[model samples]
Each structure stands twice: as C-alpha cells, then as structure tokens.
Target: MEEFFKKYKIELEKEELEKFEKFLEIFKQKNSQINLSAIRDDNGIIEKHFVDSVMLNIFLDFLEIENPKVADLGTGGGFPLIPLAIVNPEVNFVGIDSVGKKLKAIDEFVEELELKNVKTLNGRAEEIGQNL
Candidate 1:
C-alpha cells in the first residue's frame, strides 16, 4: 500500500486516505443488509475495491487530464468512483448503479465523506450513456 501511494503521490490526499478507511467500514456494515458487493471480506475489499479504486489516479495522470469527468459504470458500492473522487477532489465523478440498495449505500457513503463533486445515479450506464 505504501508503494502504491508512493507511485502516485500527486493524486493521493491525506483526507482521502481517511475517507477510504471510513468507506471500508461503511461497506462492511451495509453488506449485512444488501448484497452490494460479492467480496465481503476485509482483505478483498482493501485489495479489489480500495486499492483498485485509488489506482485510477494513475490512469487519470497517464491520460494527462487535469480535471476530467469520470463515470463509473455499474459502480456497485462506489468501487473505483468514491475513492477516486476522494483522491481527486478536483475531478468530477458520477457513479451509476441500477440497484437501489447499492445506490443507497453509495449515497450514505458520499454524504458521510462530505464529497461535493461526486454524484450517484440509480440506473444502467448503457441507458444513461445513450442520453449523454
């Protein structure tokens, strides 16, 4: 994890690190009620969700997009969207999920993290993308 942060120092933020941890906790609690994610284990969440999500910063940097608008298609439980939003507060992030329960979890997570540039929509990306 330290290596991951060191590799992408410019995009990572201290506040985002804190929010990522909080997001993990919230996912754990919400998992009991709804099947938001298939990976219910802590290690899985940390690796597949948290780490993978944060890694998007590297992609953004590679693209040389200073303030790109990102859409996380089928962003179940806010994977690769919430963490990316936290790390790159300057960028806009929109999470799309058809599951109401999952969207609810994402809304709660976004509110808890006090994110301003992140939005959650309860629908499929295929349907939304056509309108865009």
Candidate 2:
C-alpha cells in the first residue's frame, strides 16, 4: 500500500501509512459483518477506496481556504471523508449518510483511527444541508 501510494507522488508519513493500513483492516472486518463496501479484497480497498479518495488532493490547491471545512454527502464507510480527514488533520470533515448502520460503522472507524477532526451524521443530505 505504501509503495502504491508513492507511485502517485502521495508520500504518506509512517504514522499516516500505519493508520491507512489499520483502516483497511477495520474496513474489511466491518464489511464482513455488514455491507459497507463492494470492494472486498486488500487490493480493491487500496485501489478503489483509499487511492480513489486520496485523489481528491488534486483539488486542495483550488480550495484556497485556510483550515477548510468539507462535507461529504452519502459518505458510506467514510471513503473520501475518512481518508481526507486522516491526511488533513487540521481540516474539519463532516460525513453524512442516509443509512444509520453505515454511519455507525463510520463512527467506529473514526474512533479507531483517533480522528479528532471528523463528525458523522445519519440523515439525508437535503435535511442536513438545509440546517447547516
């Protein structure tokens, strides 16, 4: 996974890489208990989930916001949101999903990763967006 990330010039620190590795393990375990993701294997998770999510880094420069806050709608199992939050600990992230169970899994993932900058909401994006 570390080698794969380096191929994209996205060099993760040792700790960050460890967190991503841990996330993969947790994701697989949770997926076994509940349908969190369709990509089941390690390679799939790395390529389809983690790498895909990290690709959002390309837009970071365009954001042009100091200490940016982001909202990811229908962030099932915390795809872009979790990975983004992991890499950018200074930024804030909110992940909203319609399924309560999926949010629960995300909450567990957040806690397991010891992420302080993320929050999860179990509701439709429209309802939550309006209030925010």
Candidate 3:
C-alpha cells in the first residue's frame, strides 16, 4: 500500500498510513462475515478498493471547494468515501447504503479508524436524498 501511494507521488503521514492499514485489516475481517467485497486478497483490495477510492483525489482540484461536502450514494463497504475521508480529514463525507448490515460494518470501520469526518446513513439514496 505504501508502494502504491509512492507510485502516485502521494505522501501520507505515518499515522494516516497506519489508519489505512487498520481499515484494510478490519475490512477483510468483516468481509469474511459479510459480503462486503468480492476482492478477497490484499493486492486486489489495495488496487480495486483503496487505490480506486483514493483516485477521487484527481478531481479535487476541479471541485475547488474548501472543506468540500461529499455524499457517496450506494457506498457499499465505504468505497471511495472511507478512503477519501481518510486522506482529506477536513472534508465531510456522508455514505448512504440501503444494506443495513453493510452500514453496520462501515460504522464499525469508521469507529476503528477513528474517523471524525464521516457519517453513515442506512437508507436508500433516493429516499434519503429527497428528505435531505
């Protein structure tokens, strides 16, 4: 994972990097209990989930919003939202998923990672978006 970040020229603080490692550990453990992801191996998770999620940073310059508020609809297993929140702690992230079990697992992941800027909503995107 560190190599992946280095490949992209992204420097992560030690603490931040540890948090991502912890997230990956917890994700794998929970995934075994629930179908959080189909990619079971470390390399697959790193590339498909961690790297893929952090790819959102490429669009950050275009957003041009300080402390941007991001809503990830149908954010299964936290996906881009968790990784995005991890890298950009100042930004706010709201992850909405219809699967209650998945949301529960994400809640646990958020707590384990000690993420302060993320919140999960257990509801359909359409219904939740309408109310919001």
TM-scores for every candidate against the unseen true structure = 0.84, 0.97, 0.95
Which residue pairs collide, candidate 1? Answer: none
The 10-residue segment of model 2 with minimum total lDDT is 55-64
How would you encode candidate 2's per-residue C-alpha lDDT over 55-101 as one tens digit per residue?
89789757789988899999987889999888989889999999999
Off by over 4 Å in 2: none
| Model 3's TM-score against the true structure | 0.95
Candidate 1 — what's its lDDT?
A: 0.80
Runs with alpha carbons beyond 4 Å of true place in candidate 3: none
Q: Write the per-residue lDDT of candidate 1 for residues 70-112, one digit (tens) a residue.
A: 9888888788888788878889989998888888888888898
RMSD after Cα superposition, model 2: 0.8
Put down candidate 3 lDDT per residue, 10-125, tens digits, no spaces: 77889889998998899999999999999999988987898888888889758899768899999998899899899989989999999999999988998999999999998999
Q: Give the TM-score of candidate 2.
A: 0.97
Report the backbone clash tally of model 1: 0
Task: Quantify all predictions' global Cα lDDT against the true fold.
Answer: 0.80, 0.91, 0.89
- As for lDDT, the candidate ahead, 1 or 3, is 3
Best by TM-score: 2
| Model 1 per-residue lDDT at 63 | 89
